[model samples]
Target: MPGERTKYAWRREILATRAQVSPAEHAVEAAALAASNTRLTGVDDVVCAYVPVRGEPGDLRMLDALREHGATVLLPVTGEPGPLSWARYEGPDSLRKARYGLLEPTTETLGPATVAEAATILVPALAVDRRGVRLGRGAGYYDRTLGAARADVRLIAVVRDNELVDRLPEEPHDRRMGWALTPDGGLRQLGRDLPVSPE
Candidate 1:
């Protein structure tokens, strides 16, 4: 199994792979992902989600689909490299270009603790292992934010089907995903019971 040093290598490899995905493939995957949202959370649930940037797994329509399903959606507001603040996602028209080229909601800013209001949180990951270890883009945003969420909240990492691997380097501060949502695979429950240490 790969260790901490290999994590950066994994990030580079995964990102390069994602960058090669054609627009046609991305559209198909985005449509499929939007269709699978209902299986991940129920109506009336507060969902903490993010807008896909840099060829990530989802599109804005995924957020709209959640709203159409009767759930209130919240988008992250990037601040000074800490727990993310959120704002209600009204629609595509409600978003404004923010830091790091991210689109954020134009509504009032909700505090970091607001993540606890979500019943499900759609996390962005470069890849996730069967054991629920998530590899992020080296930024500690989700790491800091997830610590403030409700313990029972569904932490689902959204990735491509191929991004779901057998194992990933794990750190003590890393928050494990309870589930993974892939375009082709839909929603899959991860094996949290699996041992964290590498064999």
Candidate 2:
């Protein structure tokens, strides 16, 4: 029997099979790499980062580095089906538990209009291909959000090294990444900027 698989199944299988590493170590390396790359570019001012939930790629280290570099941070707040609201990330203290295991900011909530002002956005992905196409959590939150942002905004996907692969099933609306930050290899351009084949 050819059984059908749900989107949740794809997300679970990939996440379960991903390399298991100490969160602290991965956070340290990813933070240093991201910080270095952000400094070199000189364009990243306001960054969008996620609050670690369900053991995603980055921990608080990435947020800390961005703040230390004088970049304002924003986090996603669950909104309607196709849009997301962002709130200025003041600190860990400003977070409150939300649905889907996501910790969101409780300070000042902002509308989607503010996303355009961000110079860079660090997106969370389940898997990303060499073409920079990202497979997210399947809610289509980022796809809709990124679609509305300015074309020049740097959309970087943060993932474990192995998760950044050569190829993945892509949809037309899937947003591409300009860079990928991994613990092992530091920061590397994923698709548009580099000619490397997808792993």
Q: Residues 1-199, candidate 2: write the lDDT tens digits.
A: 2465444676787778654666676667556655554452343477877876676766676776778777888899887786778998887788899988889988889998778878788889887777888878888888888876777887777777777877677677777888776666556677654532221
RMSD in Å for all candidates: 4.7, 4.2
lDDT of 1: 0.90
Q: Write the per-residue lDDT of candidate 1 for residues 14-86, one digit (tens) a residue.
A: 9999999999999999999998886567889999999999999889989989999899999999999899999
The pairs that clash in candidate 2 are 165-199, 166-198, 166-199
In candidate 2, which residue ranges exceed 4 Å CA deviation? 1-10, 19-44, 192-199
* Best prediction by lDDT: 1
lDDT of each: 0.90, 0.73
